[model samples]
Target: MKKATIKDVAKEAGVSISTVSNALNNSPLVSEDTKNRIIQIAENIKYVPNMNGKMLKARKSMTVGVFSSSVSGHYFYILVDSVFKELRRRGFGLNIVINKDKRALLSNVLSKNFDGIIVFDNERVGEHEVELIVQNQIKTVFLDRDLNGADVSSVLFDSYKSGYDLTKYLIHLGHKRIYFIEGEENTYDNLERKRGYTTALKEIGVEIKEEYFFKGMFEESYAYNDVISRFRLGNSQIPDAIVAANDYSAIGCIKAFSRLGYRVPEDISVVGFDDIEVARYFTPTLTTVRNPIARQGIRAVEILMDMMNNDMPGVSEHLAGEIIYRDSAKAKVL
Candidate 1:
């Protein structure tokens, strides 16, 4: 059967093509009853509006949206900056949104206000939201989400390896009393990294200490508070080292530890993931996992632009993390 057109909808509804157009666009010129009749007829006949004409009328915006669950912290800022630069180089505008609510995020994405969108890893996004992406046929590149669906592709980081490699390195340094600053326990990155940490510890016969684990919200203040609270709870001795989920938490731990007259590496070694810029220049210089943050940004944009321009699904990638040793952590002394 031939694809239905506005004329077909107009004929089926006993209305003019112009009226059908108005109804399809939800123009107020059509009465509510008439609009509903036209819409039902259009749906029945599978008629689609002339989006190309509408797009041409407005002109290509060359704009894309980038949504992140949290926009603060050095990690996100660095990634945003990199993504911005990449988009700028390609003559595409980048609109960044901090997704505070999943419902609102899905609404904006489904609105088709941009050519395409890149979604950073978000635990708040559920299966229903992913189905919306498929339902609307939105061109989306998911950063670290690894969602499986039509018109939804992903860019992933090997977070489990990121955690395991760093943890194993700390173990190699003879640090058995390793405390963990876990970030958003429910998040995929945190879970993967935690697995790696535990795996490395288990291999070396070091039973993971439950008391040494602190919950983190992937922020500096939370980590800072947790460290301070532990000290106030009559803790005089420090763990051999603390492995934080991210650089922000690690920095917070280092600051809190420093304020308590504890020197990093000398008093308590610290390790972090995501080698943000400040991590390399902090007081003791953080030892961290180089998370390819900039590359992640660049890759996200590349994939998004490819999908937008070629109308193709971009290939997914799983990048490995590497340990970058610095002054923040040193071999434990026997």
Candidate 2:
């Protein structure tokens, strides 16, 4: 004889799968009478919840899950490493899942595989999914976007202010004709950074030219090719300075300028955000905004632990950035 599943119990009780799940988890959304009916039906059918679900009910998984879109960059490496060390010190384990499929991501999240989750994939987990997670009472800390819920918190970098300040600094260095490189479209950090750049330009009475904007996709090679192609086309005028979305893209822009026989900060100044490990080691040494990557991870863990252990309400925290002046950029010679 085959064992009974939640779906089988739901069918027998004529209730939704979510209703069955809520009843089993003792969620308050279901009425007392409905909850009792579901429980009785589940018992009659011998329905058995998954082991992870059982752990969730008992609240003893002793682990956290990190859901990310991609974990290949230097930024993610530092963030995850910090989270790992912090969790280890507290006697907990870590699980990382990288998936682009929203359905699979949702399933993994709802599976209760971990006690709490730290989400970095804004594309996969949007407003609707977040609501479902909250309904299920999963403690979550979002790294890439800002959201507040009963059990959801956000830890974010102050991208807008940093971008504005960096651009203002460039303008102060006597740069007038400035070009901007963009990251992936519609991302929270990317959007905020772009907004700051444009705001700074407008405040200084500088015209924001659409032709000066180029897509770099936050990748070094993409930024390199974008720069090289623009220069090779000969249709666009060379700007006095260029601002890239991140350090990797900035380094790529530098390499492209070098290949075109243009000297960095001599022929054209350049700057980027996120002072990654390689920023200082690059030939010209990138000038950038230092994002608190490790601190973000550490603080995220602290907040999640508080929610999971102490039953604290979620809160939002914003980390600020610092300007790191380096050799890659300089004042324009009048």
Candidate 3:
């Protein structure tokens, strides 16, 4: 069995190699009938383009490499979706590389034959990873998280503001001694959100309590157990409300109370961040900071394209998170 090439397709179609190339690349010079005939012959011979070799020869892959944490029901998915759409619109292809470990992520991304790369959830990135990325000399843009030492383009969202504003809103509703459910320990977003929470409490003359915080529990079962443990341990003061780092944690808190025979906003108010799609459809719609997850994706690609064109200037961009009020949170009574 012989591998087919442009020459083979051309020979089979009784046309020149250039004609085959033009047809495959969708060049306008080839007639519609000729293009169809060439494509049919290539298909019959199972001739697919060798992108890897082509990229090597061209010295520019014309493809953007995307490094995502995961492509499931996470915030990263929203960003990846937006980037894919924007890359296509800009006439560039995309490649997604997923790995949680910094070393592995960097190895996979840097080794790939690509012109540019975008890093999502930058918390996993380390100094070594930074060195790798910088050493590669590839155009790069970071989304959702920032690299401390990387002197490159980034599009960020104000997680701190999201946390601060949401907490402040709860405080204005008379919530004091608010409990904070944190996100993953190493995540930059979690740290910023906590800062915002602390800032709000400080502004209201309310001191943050060590006992009012919990960790290692981001899911519904974890939240329910934490609430139960607090009750069983005779913890007298249940904060007026619980503020989660994101909507998933917030929803978990709500479910915990519901199972324990408590009503939301009526018994105790709760607020979450990110305002993921499920927030709106919850039993009592969530009151959260509406993170522009999808838009961030779209902007990332647009910026990366600018970087690709050598027109990218040194600039840091941040998108504000909007607050959406729903039935989940309410002012506490004096």
Name the top TM-score candidate. 2
**Quality of model 3 by C-alpha lDDT:** 0.75
Report every candidate's CA lDDT.
0.79, 0.88, 0.75
Lowest lDDT sum, 10 consecutive residues, model 1, at 50-59
User: Of the candidates numbered 1 and 3, which has the greater lDDT value?
Assistant: 1
Ranking by lDDT: 2, 1, 3
**C-alpha TM-scores of all predictions:** 0.76, 0.83, 0.77
Instruction: Between candidates 1 and 2, name the one with more favorable TM-score.
Output: 2
lDDT of 2: 0.88
* Candidate 1 lDDT, 237-259, residue by residue in tens: 67999989999999999999888
Question: Any residue pairs clashing in model 1, and if so which?
Answer: none
Error of 2 at 178 (Å): 1.4
Write one digit per residue (lDDT tens) for candidate 3, span 151-230: 35677888888888888898888888799998787676788889999998998788677887866244656666777766
- Highest lDDT: give the candidate number: 2
